[model samples]
Target: MSGIHLAYDLSFTHTEGRWNQPGAWVGSDFPDVKMFLELARTAERAGVDMLFFGDGSGIPSTWRGSIEPAVEWGIQWPRQDMSPIIAAMSTVTDHIGFGLTYSSTFMHPFYVARLLNSLDHVSGGRIAFNVVASSRGADAANYGYAQLADHDQRYERMEEFIAVCRALWDSVSPDAIERDRATGRFADPAKVHPIDHTGEFFTVKGPLSAVPSPQHHPVVVQAGNSPRGVAASATFADLVFGFGGSLAGQQRHRAMLDAALVDEGRDPAAVGILWATQVIVGRTAAEAITRRDTVLDFWTHEAVGTMLSHNAGYDFSTLPESFRLGELREEIIAANASPAGFIGALVTELGADTVITRDEFFEHGFLAASGLDHTVIGDAATVAETLEQNHADTGARGGFMLSSPLAMPSAYAELSELLVPELRRRGALAPRYPGSTLRENLAV
Candidate 1:
């Protein structure tokens, strides 16, 4: 395995939610296929191992029971399905893999299995699935649910969802298909067995309609941070998307995931834990910070409140400005599956006992809104040093998932021009993919 494996976390929107900026290409140009193809080509040229898509199925109405801010700022609305884009991009690149997100909360496993399997075959074993449990009520409503499933219940459903998909994927053995002209036989019936699976959430019968695609099963990726989420990742995920707040925080999460793997009777090193981070690089430190500030300036108090309320799944606008967040722990927990782990983080930043009033929460959110979990801003050398140090300190064999605030073209170009070369020089970035499959390349 290379010292650090890099993947690009891509979104179709303006990078980091800065919309309507003059001369910036975002919403109106998102559907342009030419732009996506070039972006994929750029990432492949940078030797990026995979292009991971982060997806949401619904427009936000959780913020003060309103979708105004999300619609106004283009905060993850007007979303498009990424499957076709993945197919198009895969045709243009040989080795760069694609990770597509699908939620277990709404879709049937059989359909998902077929679609992703075909994509994997078409892409020559270069595709992965980022499994998610849908949390928003809007998404659940669209799927015909009155309210979202309870937090743990959602995870329970997901476990069964993955189980059914796995069985279906393995229903047809590798040697099942054979074109024999002499006997006029196409496939060996004995080799293709029925997966008569009957679980609490899903009951799937027989083998899939299509033959087994390349990679047998596309790489299983998960970003479950809650207890149930961790267990699901440990049991089924090939790659686990993780948080990167600090070296200590990263190390703690890694340890928990490793332990979960042990409980599943799997080797700790078998699963790759990838940390998602945002980077701002410039010719100098000051230049980078200036760019970061420009991004941060977009986070007004109202914007912060809207974004926070949306993420936490609770309306902060309903609470008084002087109310202490500590007292509402239970309510927050009840509100969302992964209640703003950010709330806990904000409290930590302000001191443990500090009351997180509405004003304080908005201020902190506004300050840090532009940055991701582990934001790095610096010149190329400084950024490289920080990444290398974090990798060493946290023992992250899985490496980092990078996002550039600049949209696709600028982001990919900057990475190829500035950051990736630095990593290559330090022997951190892999010179080439080890094999045709994403599983082979991401193996640590």
Candidate 2:
């Protein structure tokens, strides 16, 4: 394994009350490009592998079937298409790779492929595409779907989506661009060929009309923790994004993914899992604990409900006052929603037959929505040691994806400044920026 790889999950930097947190979003508002520009520089200087942004295009409206709570509380709303933001960030920092997410469920593969090719050229091959089969009903509504596609069907689409993208990326041979200035000949007809792709989901013809970027195919990243999802990741993902909430869950995911990789005729050790771990670091453990407490003050019932229901793609507000855990999972799966989220985790912890009250469910949801449950908080050394242990337990293949519930710029500064340096000093991190393109730099 290539030591430990660290990436900052810039996905929700301004969401879930983080903007109002101390040391976060001080001067800039959400979608402020300048904030990202400065952040990119800080992360790159700290030798962070990549900066990631997760996307969901619609407002969160799953709570009681209204958009009010999400809008009022700013629960995972106001997300921008980070493609341009990433392009702008690339210009300011040359080495840091950027992860931009797009949904395979909502978008056409051709548009996404062409757009990523241009961004790859812009960033000098420093772009990673996080292809997702979107799960939220709110997102589906925005895309004009009355309901989400079946869970298994979504993964099916995702595999085909990557297949189409790869074919498109390979359509134009690297030698296709023969710019002979002396002869004024700019042609290589034999090298350029049509993809002529006709699949269950997409249909396209002809070669991609663009020069190949430094890395012909951008690094493909996927985060799918369900059994079907894990199978799909084993098939296409260059890097797997796993939740860091539970070590046992992560271990299971790694083992399942390894077996799936073997079945796919791929090497499991070659793929790494970047666990999405939230953190709050201070000079001292007490200070970090204080910062962690601040998360408790921000969530309310409506806010918690919105956050939980939107992600599950089922309305938690509709849940009865008392229900069995198995019943909830059944309902979620029956609705064509996700069964492997917090509910699945709860099932693993408490037996599936265990009954939970409405209050109890939202109580758990509060900690999750606020990011306090999975957050690792302490002094740099303590936090670093926790990461080391977790990495080793989870196969030590990929590293942690550090996220913060504190403010941006400052919170990220603490991570880049205090935490990463500690890991390097301990010799616990992989070589920093050791390659040219992201595909090489982040390889495990």
Q: Which one is best on lDDT?
A: 2
TM-score per candidate: 0.94, 0.98
Mark the 10 consecutive residues where model 2 has the least summed lDDT.
Answer: 21-30
- lDDT assessment of candidate 1: 0.78
Clashes of each: 0, 2
> How do the residues 19-115 of candidate 2 rate in per-residue lDDT, one tens digit apiece?
8888776557879999999999999999999999998998988889899988888889789888889999999998889999999999998898899
True-structure RMSD, every candidate: 2.1, 1.1
For model 1, residues 1-444, the per-residue Cα lDDT tens digits are 437888888764463454443335555467677777988898888798999887877777777787888788766566789899899999999999999999999999999998988999989999899888877766776789887778888888888888888888899987889989999999999989889988888888968877888799889999877667888888888888986576666776788899999999998877777887888888799978776766665676666776666666667788776755565555777765345356656654555456666676666666455555568989999999998888877665688888866555665567777998888988886547889798888873
Clashing pairs in 1: none
In order, the Cα lDDT scores of the candidates are 0.78, 0.89
Model 1 segments more than 4 A misplaced: 12-28, 347-353
